[model samples]
Target: MTSTFHVRGGRPLKGEITVRGAKNLVSKAMVAALLGEEPSLLRSVPDIRDVAIVTELLKVHGVKVDRDVATGLIRMDPSNVERAHAAEIDAHAGSSRIPILFCGPLLHRLGEAIIPDLGGCRIGDRPINYHLDVLREFGAHVDKRELGIHITAPNGLKGTKIHLEYPSVGATEQVLLTAVRAEGVTELTNAAVEPEIEDLIAVLQKMGALITLQTDRTITIEGVERLGGYEHVAIPDRIEAASWACAALVTKGDVFVQGAQQKPMSTFLNVFRRIGGGLDITDDGIRFFHPGEPLRSIAMETDVHPGFMTDWQQPLVVALTQAEGISIVHETVYENRLGFTSALNDMGARIQVYRECLGGSSCRFGWRNFNHSAVISGPKALHGADITVPDLRGGFSYLIAALGAEGISSIHGIDLIDRGYESFREKLTALGAEYWED
Candidate 1:
């Protein structure tokens, strides 16, 4: 059954909330467990839909997934891992793109990997061609079937050099997972160097893999004959921390995010300060609040790591609705990210989507027909409206708009938010944001 949230607006949210492990890192780490010859212990695992999906996917492949929910620990034993049926894998991995990451590990272990049609957020065209091409580079033969693609390595897998055109995260992950067990060293240039990728590298190292990061965006993995278990602590959820920070700004509230780190969120923190949001960076966590001053609007662009993240742009856009002047957000990451702004516009915010890159250098989608940029004319008082949660980040942005509106908002498809945010409703209640289930 679908769930809905009835949010009563105009009250500022206050108090503290804790964020868990990075959603981006945790799932890939779980997939990395399958490469180990022994059980891997992962700490700080979040209780989210994606984690659950990954857990189920691992269990289907005969990995023993033992959980300690109280302490957020998961012990994944891959000793009994075996080939899983195509239908079974499809059933557990519904609407998740994680199955593609399984291709590398599964092909190494079982000599074959079957992946059903992949699904993820509709923010852009995240095709798996990069993944398929990477697999082909490693001598995997792809056979298309009615259900999904079946991939197999006739000869044992061998490492090869790969250079991504756009530094796609998934392609980089595919190379890392596959190259760790291949026959020779793999060199990858123009790779994604996000913090989550670094954490994954740490996990691989603990499992006896030789990997190195260059000063440039290049990664090298020396293939090993065997990999053992890993004991690792996943990184904090910077996206979730930034999302709460934006929530505090939009509602003119004060929030103490208990586990936020300053390093990963440095770019976001800079943008938050430029937008006139109050922030205090500390050793433990970051405190975000409204400074009781007029919020300023600024031109922003979303790029890869070290730039403003595309995931952070959605929730931050909700706060931009309350800014005093025109704010231009050029989304260089996703083509359809600004579509969720339509709901905010319905709530009395003045946000216009444009096909041309308005505030920054022309990006890949600038000359294309895709409307990838947004111009928000704000300080407009927002009212309540019925809305639908589109994707994970977009869903959270809707909740932010609803909480800051002047009237009650009826939100459908609220379950989408659970894919990333951990116990957000409980945290919202603790922060004194008035919301009820409908």
Candidate 2:
């Protein structure tokens, strides 16, 4: 069944919503459970499609997964993990890129692993070569087959040094999961230091993995003989928190996001403040609201951790439409993320995407023809239109546009949002958002 959201516009959203464990972190932590010799308990797990996908994948591998939806708790036992059939694995994987992550753990536990063609949101050209190359570096033999790419560690997995061309988070995760149980010490340079990555490291540490993060983007992991279970609470979802913050600004509303943290979101909070949004940081959570003053335009660039995130670019772009003057956004992380702006333009947002890199320093896509930079000319009045959700982040941004538009918007492909945000429809209702699902 296809899911659609019919949203009525021109009303401000106001109220409180809670964010749970990060969609980015929880799925990976689920994969981490495969390395544990015993059962592991995870708390603050969100009710999202990705988590469900991981749970199913684990079950297929003979891992016992006990889940409590109400408390957002998951107990995963990988003590009996075994090889699953290729077709079954492929069927369970569906369009998720998660299966790629199973390679290391499966290889370590069963001496072989098979990963089918991976799929994810159409946000960028995220290649799997980084993952495959890291696996090969660790003595895994990769073979191309009709069923999927089969990997085997004949000589047993051994650790090695790896340096990433870019600080890719997924590839870093692939290395951490594989390296924690390899035969020797592993060192990774130019690794991604996202808070989610750190949280995963914490999970591994709890499982008896010795990992260290240096001042530089280098991470060192010492392979251990055995790993035990861990009970861990994941970090809050900063992307979702920032999304709601942008929603509050776009709709001229106030939203108190419980479970939102201040440290991981420091960069986003600075950007939100620079755009003239109000933020009240506390020990518990952060409160975001419009200051009733005209929103200001600012030049921003998306980068890795400790910088403005690419996921924040979309929703913030929708809010930028209501800002006075021109706001420049340079999406350096994803080469094609700005493609979603066309839908916003259709809703009367004056956003122009350009191939040439704009705002601060030139990036990896500086010379590419892809439209990676966006110039938003705003304070433009928006009218609702028929909208199609593009990707996860873009889909949420479309909802914000619909809520702020003047008329009703029929939004299709809203199920994409379920891949990330948890209880979004209920949260929208709590925030006084006028919407219905069909």
Candidate 3:
């Protein structure tokens, strides 16, 4: 069944909301359980579609995944795992980038793996060239099959140095997971230093893996002979936190986001403050509101971790439409990220896309008609309209845009929003948002 959200706009949202575990970290943590010799326990897991898909994928691979919905805890036991059925495995091929992380653990346990085509956010040509290059560097024989990637480490996997041309999150994670079980030491330079990556490392360390973080740019791993099961609490969702923060700005409301840690969200908080958004950090969360002045325009550039996240860019761009002056956004992560801005433009926004690098960064999308840069001229009154959500973050941006617009908005493809958001309908209702499913 498909669900769409019918939202009545122009409401000032109030009240407190708690964020769930990090979607990015929880999925990777589930995959890490496959590498363990015993059952691993993961806490703070969110009830979402992508996590459910990953759990099913692990079950098909002969891993026993026991999920406790009430407690948000999951136990995965791969002790008796042997082989994965291709038909069952292929059903979820191209579902997410996460399934690819299983390649290393599968090869480590069964000596071979057949991975189906990968799928995730379609913001650009997110090619797996970097993944294949890093895996082959570690002595894995990779062959492209009709259905997916066929890999074998007949001579056994060995550790090697990998240098990524771009600090891609997926590629960096693939290297870390695959290299942790290799025969020797693996050195990775120019890796993505996202907080989720750090969380994964912490989980690996708890499982008795010999890993060290040398500076923010490099990681050194000494492959161990065996890994033990571990128990860990996943980090809070920073992307979700930032999205709700933008919701406060767009609606000119006050919202308190519980469980949103400030340590990992410092960069985003700084940007929000620069745009005239107010923040107050408490023991367990952060509260966002606009008290006196309207939002101000600021320049933004998306990059790897510790920089502006690409996932948060869409929602923030929507909020920028209510700002005073012109706002510039340069997307350095994905080429097609700015395409969703057209939907906002349909609702009376002055946003222009350009093919050249407008904000002093040479992005991959700059020369290819990808329109890597966006210039938003705003303080315009937005009217609600029917809009279609293109992807996860884009869908959330539409929700924020709708909350600040006049009249009614009918948003389609709302199920995509559920892939990451948990009980979003109930939460919005609690915060004074009039949303219903039709």
Clashing pairs in 2: none
Q: Candidate 2 on 335-432: residue-level lDDT in tens?
A: 98988999998999899988888998999998878999999998998898998998999999999999899999999999989999998999998988
How many clashing pairs does model 2 include?
Answer: 0
C-alpha root-mean-square deviation, each candidate: 0.8, 0.8, 1.3
Residues 1-438 of candidate 3: C-alpha lDDT, one tens digit per residue: 556888998998899898878999999999988888988999989888888888988988888999987678999999976777656777864457767788888889889887787778788887777778878888999999887788899988899988888888888889888888999999999988899999999999998898888785889999988998999999999999999999998898999999999999998999999999999999879999977698899988988878888888998999899999999999988888899989899988889998888776687766677788999998888899999999999999999999989989999989989889977887898899998787
Q: Is candidate 1 or candidate 3 better by lDDT?
A: 1
Tell me how far the alpha carbon of residue 132 in candidate 3 is from the true structure, in angstroms, after superposition.
2.0
Segments of candidate 3 deviating more than 4 angstroms: none
The model with the greater TM-score, 1 or 3, is: 1
lDDT of 1 by residue, 335-413 (tens): 9999999999999999999999889898999889998889988899989999998899999999999999999999999
